[model samples]
Target: MDNNSCGCNVCSTREDLPWEGRGTDLPIAGCRFTLYPMTDRYVDIILGSLEKTDTSYVWSETDALSTVYRGKLPYVADAVKALFVNAYRSGVHMALEGQFSKGCPGDIAGDSLLEKDGEAPNAKSAEGIHFPVKCKLALYPMGVGNYIDDIAKVWYMAQDRGLEPTTIHYATRISGDVHDVFDYLRDVCALMDESAVSHYILHFTVNCNSPTKE
Candidate 1:
């Protein structure tokens, strides 16, 4: 069993029980100490913010983020816009991608074209895009593929969320807006209902440019 599910008091209690867990004065590699009252304060601070909003709020330009979805997403629609403009005093064509990146197995996360002349990637290619605005989607799976077509009124389950995406990406753009990503998923799941596939995962984030496929 992985360390997280371990029921030992060390795993269940104080996480600060030192990364080097001890019992009878012997250190264990995966053992941990109980969470002392001091560390609980930090956990409270972090979780307290999560309970505040399901989405990012307008952050002042100077605030920092070591985590995403918990802290505010940098707002481009407000005074925060100035931060991005001022950051690019060097006259860049576009914001150079940052190192903060992750992806599913074999998923592409950046630009497909080489030097502005390379051929565009193919369908089923994993691609990414970034949106200047934030939009949320409440997606409900419609069975799997065409079998879902047999089920009436699946879209209505999602229609109530009031999200209309200006840019609809097939499977390429995995960033920017979760709404667009889910829209594509809503379409795909309705198509895959009869295929060999049983389930799929959709991942979305801020601006990532990699192609999802090789």
Candidate 2:
């Protein structure tokens, strides 16, 4: 068979096909983020909190820097939100930075491919691609005292409206439907101004594109 003939719906005889046209479905998508506990007490609380059972995600912690969670988009978001909420309830200052992508980006998690007919394709296979939604985010608890509580108020408000966030040096990367990403951002912004903190900070970068292009 010719290089252009893969005998699959994904393959066409056009070498000039744009990356987006190559495939629309991806098998695995995820995000990477770093959690920052502003104080020693907050650090301990955050680390200890992660020690609990969380079957919804495949997560890893690196001593005192960050944690990487890989799994379905919804599960990842839920896990991050729960962590933030629980940490805030402890009354400690904290922040989270992250990035989310639908298709494999550097295979940071190492599970970017799926087996197909006893072999894995060298490139992204449409059979396993998830919907393409990419976003970057950051969450910070402001003020010196009672900041966690202040941030918590905004956190829940964002949740009430719906937002999920993550970081730089460390980032929480997530990929999914375009609408879902937008909804997450909208909620984050809504809480930025309502928090009790003197100045709550939230940062975001969003992209909707194919894995190949990302």
Candidate 3:
């Protein structure tokens, strides 16, 4: 009858969650990803890598299908990238499928969207103002994967063009000029198509708006 040994979801505790008592008040971003291992070694590598993450992030593991991270935009991005880097370093072929969001159209608890302070910004505000752009991305065969190289290329392309890109888990959020944002996305899709391996599937979505926007 002990809850700890019962393995019941209902008996599980979320009181330790970073946002447990805090309502969705802070402007934050989040992402969820399913890590697919080409080999069983991925589990250890992932767990080891996670233990090494130094940032303060709200992470939740759901069985074996996926894990979610929530925090400020930069922290979330860093944690995701750190995990990916460790997985790659382990030399295991892996794939990640996930969604990223910031300022989307729904309640944070229900939609997994990033929290924002106000409504969506206008064109005038957008001109000089930077905003979050949620994106979904998948990369397969992690170590020496074709998709990895292509993604690196796109990342550099964004930087070279003066865009602010934050990678969250398997997804990314890029903020900058709207034209630059779309252009980066266009190039990413093109590169993925051009460099994808036979065993890979690349899928993603880009949502550009504050999650709290009306």
Models 1 onward score TM values of: 0.20, 0.40, 0.41
147 Cα displacement, candidate 3 (Å): 25
- Give the C-alpha lDDT of model 3: 0.47
Cα lDDT of model 1 by residue, 7-71, tens digit: 34545565564433422211100100111112324445333432332222322121233322111
Instruction: Estimate, for each residue in 1-77, the C-alpha lDDT of model 2 and write its tens digit.
Output: 22223333454444554432332233333445565556657657766656542523434344454566555444444
lDDT of 3 by residue, 56-119 (tens): 4444455566677665444454455445444443333454555544322222444333443232
Candidate number that wins on TM-score, 1 or 3 = 3
List lDDT for all candidates, in order: 0.26, 0.44, 0.47
TM-score rank order: 3, 2, 1
Query: Candidate 3, TM-score vs. the true structure?
Result: 0.41
Worst 10 residues of 3 by lDDT: 1-10
Candidate 2, backbone clash total: 25
- For candidate 1, what is the TM-score? 0.20
Error of 1 at 67 (Å): 9.2
Give the winner by TM-score: 2 or 3. Answer: 3
Ranking by lDDT: 3, 2, 1
